[model samples]
Target: QQQVRQSPQSLTVWEGETAILNCSYENSAFDYFPWYQQFPGEGPALLISILSVSDKKEDGRFTIFFNKREKKLSLHIADSQPGDSATYFCAARAYQGGRALIFGTGTTVSVSP
Candidate 1:
């Protein structure tokens, strides 16, 4: 079964607008959330992440809004650009000491100019 899930399997946004991606998890053991951005032929790169202790984490134009109680989170890309078009994956790592990260189905975002 899928432990993590993402909504809006695909999304489109105009340049300068914010692109929002939603994610949820079924495992309560998850404590760390990392969002990855992947290009067409490249591996996914860590974009931003948040711990279960915090409600939000922001790095430049990228931000992650997390709600531990609800087992939900969202990634918001501010001032989106065409170069930002790619697939985004929401991944989670449990606190029980496993090195594996459970990833969501992924959300493909297209930033149009």
Candidate 2:
């Protein structure tokens, strides 16, 4: 069964705007979250992430807003570009180690100029 869930299977946004992707998890044991960005025919790359201890993490135009209490999180892409169009997966892993990362269904983002 899928433990992690992501909203809006598909999204469209303007190039200069921000795109927000929402995620939530069912397992409280999960403490590490890493968002991945994948383009067609390419492997998914690590995007931005936030630990359960932090509420937010930012990298360049990408940001992850986390809510540990609610077991939810969101990825915000600022100043989106056409090149940013890709599928994003929200993945989680437990701190206990040795467990494989659980991924959400993924959100496909489209940036329109």
Tens digits of lDDT, candidate 1, 18-108: 9999999999989999999999999999999999999999999999999888999999999999999999999999988856999999999
The local distance difference test score of model 2 is 0.96
The TM-score of candidate 1 is 0.97
> In candidate 2, where is summed lDDT lowest over 10 consecutive residues?
94-103
The C-alpha local distance difference test score for the whole of candidate 1 amounts to: 0.96
Q: Superposing all C-alpha atoms, what RMSD in Å does each candidate have to the true structure?
A: 0.7, 0.7
Candidates' TM-scores?
0.97, 0.98
User: Against the correct fold, how does model 2 do in TM-score?
Assistant: 0.98
Write out the backbone clash pairs for model 2: none
Off by over 4 Å in 2: none
